[model samples]
Target: MKKSLAMLLAGAMVVASLTACGSGKKETTAETTSDTTAESAESKTVSDGETYKIGVLQLTEHAALDAANEGFVAALDDSGISYEIDQQNAQNDQSACQTIAEKLVNDGDDLILAIATPAAQAVAGVTTEIPIVGTAITDFADSGLVESNDAPGENVTGSSDLTPIKAQISLLQKVLPEAKKVGVLYCSAESNSEIQLQMTKEACTAAGLDVEEFSVASSNEIQSVVESAVGKVDCLYTFTDNTIAAGMNTVTMVANENNLPVICGEQGMVEAGGLCTYSIDYYELGYIAGEMAVKILKGEAEPATMPIEYYPEEKCEFVGNEETAKLLGIDISGLE
Candidate 1:
């Protein structure tokens, strides 16, 4: 009897040992699963105990781009999203833009705010998995940034600075009705400028006017190109060309010297000395982009589904530069 009892007691001890081992394994798995869930939740929460990193890739340092950056950062602050912004400018160089995009991608930027055409293209080309927000991009379709403007159908979406080309042409015609040939001066490298130039050409053609094109590959050739173009055309029209806008005075002085009036794409250009423009509010455009960013950062929206936004027609206005008008001896009495 004692031997049988000893054997049973040993059997019971073995069963207890196996059950404890099984329980330990299950407990370990449960702990690991809990950890993974916590990690996933943290990743989705931008307001978690972490500082989100934003990369600001600007094509160049200009007033418009600067305003866009300021508006984005200001909105981020207002949204109370903890963030660290790494702002960079490519200085209007494609190679530099490419380099910046690569580095930012490698750095694992949570989101990227591309301020212009080249910068947006550079970043969008590098990766499709990352979210990219464009502020002053002219045409997403023409620029090859997206499949369509209404529904971007890509990982990029933001505010478009596409003001009314017809209205701009009308303002130019109104300001200089007798003008026959209008010079379209722009940087050939910027797709935004090219798109605007083509629109202007079409609009000008429809209005029964002749268009003269003056394109330079870079800013260095702007003055010389303008010198040649100013003689052939009655007036000058400058679009949102980063290279040309960099040397604002170069084109303005060349056009003004030849007694030719200049019309521009935005108020900053006019403020820089060009005559007039039916321009969009660049600040407001930036602010809208900022609001979009807030939606993205808060996990409320995805760039993939966000439609491309445009400045409302009411937000765009016919802005005239009184100083430039005086210098060109153009009467402003008709504008008011």
Candidate 2:
């Protein structure tokens, strides 16, 4: 009886040990599974079928800005990434830009696309956390949007619509070789305009052409300001000024009535009524910005480190308005 009892106790001990071993194995498997789940969560990116929200704040409604907006959308559509976009236009109003920027921030968008300098400035004023991709902007560092073109050092980076200034000036000289004085027409309110104005003056001076300033504080003053420049200067040169771009009809009309040749900064302005430009495509510029946006979303890059982009110079075209050229009776045959 004693031997049987001892054997039974040993058997019971063995069973208990087996049960404990099974529990230990189960716990180890569970820990490994938990670690793997955490690693997977960390590795997931926007490309992993996660939907992203994008907000676009455009400064105004005009052909150039419109084309940029369209190109940005087209890029996202082609990216095959799931996303929802909220587009807002400021109508060239700074107050409107501020309001829309605040709304976008409160709504928690994954990213924001600022179409112009003012819009970018508005968004930058509101948030430093949200990634900002700007287009139609000349100099990011000069605009205080980024720390540098090579390394943003902040949450802002995008393509610059900085057309070849010297090239445009050369084209102007080619178009009107006999002209001695050029009127630099732009909105004084826009910082970008001021920056371009200074560059234009330098370029004109270097080319032995005198430049006269014709700046307007608002679109309301465009007519009077442009009229004031009609006989004072030989030709009018306007850069990528948003205010002038919005009021191109008035600018071209007044200049045209007086037979003044207006050399524009970009293709849209030339298309609207100006004579010609060594122009950069705003659509292509925006597309470049959009591509940058994709990398940011995919966790493949960060705006703080992404270099500012620009449309290839080789792709820039010398766009001219034949009708405007005909109206002004200028020989653009040399351009062709």
Candidate 3:
């Protein structure tokens, strides 16, 4: 009977040991689940708390560029995403753009916004991983920024402000219907201006008009170049060349003296002195760029995959500087 009692006691102890082992296994499983839950919550918070930073490189502080910057910032705000914008104006200097790009890359911005062709090229040369959005650029293909206008197919994409070549020619023909020979003046070093010259030459040929090109490397050459162009051509076409646009007073004086009606690529140039122009809304282009930045931040889009966007329709307006118009003797209302 004592030996039976001892065996029973030993069996009871074994049963208790098994129950304790089972309880420990259940607790271990519960603890593991709790740990995984905590880790997931932390990851989620991290993602939610991240604030994006954007670097902006503007080639100059001209009206068009300023409008673009304003539009871009507004669009970013509209996205409901928190971001810090680091904006720098390059003052129309290519070296300044390069320096600004290097600084942005060194600062490790989430993305870069290039406001013009020069600024875009500068940033693109800096880094590939940091996404880039460009605005106010004309002819992504001619700028060498991408392979095609439809699909940039690289780490850079943005909106272009290229007015339709045919439309521009039509506007010119409407304003100066009797004029035969047209002279195109631009900065030789500006690739954007070169693209415009090429397009203008083609469109003028189609319009049964003769087009001649005159190039100025800097501000000092404007007088001599303008005098030569005015002496030869009946009308003058000025592209959105920064150098010439910045020295517009001189261009207007020379052009008006020669009675050469000028048509410009951008509104700012038109306002300064040109007779009339059809241009893209640069501010809207910038706003589109801001929208692109949000997609990059949310990981919803990739720069290499983002196709370059263009304005739905070009915006046309007549500056009608009465004084300048009278000097050119262009019957503004008659043209309409």
* Candidate maximizing TM-score: 2
Instruction: For each candidate in the order shown, give its overall lDDT on alpha carbons.
Output: 0.81, 0.86, 0.78
TM-score each candidate. 0.83, 0.85, 0.81
Q: What TM-score does structure 1 among the candidates reach?
A: 0.83
Candidate 3 Cα errors over 4 Å, as ranges: 1-49, 314-319, 334-336
lDDT for 186 in candidate 3 is 89
For lDDT, the strongest prediction is: 2
- Tally clashing residue pairs in candidate 3: 0
Residues 211-291 of candidate 2: C-alpha lDDT, one tens digit per residue = 899999999999999999978999999999999999999999999999999999888898889999888888878888888
- lDDT by residue (1-336, candidate 1, tens digit) is 999999999999999999998886421111111321111111122425556767778888778777877777777777777666667777777888888888778878888889998899999999898889999898887899988887888889999988788888888888889988988988887888877888999999998889988899988998899899856888888877788878888888888788878888887888888898878887888889988988887789988788889889776876777887887889756563
Better of 1 and 2 by lDDT: 2
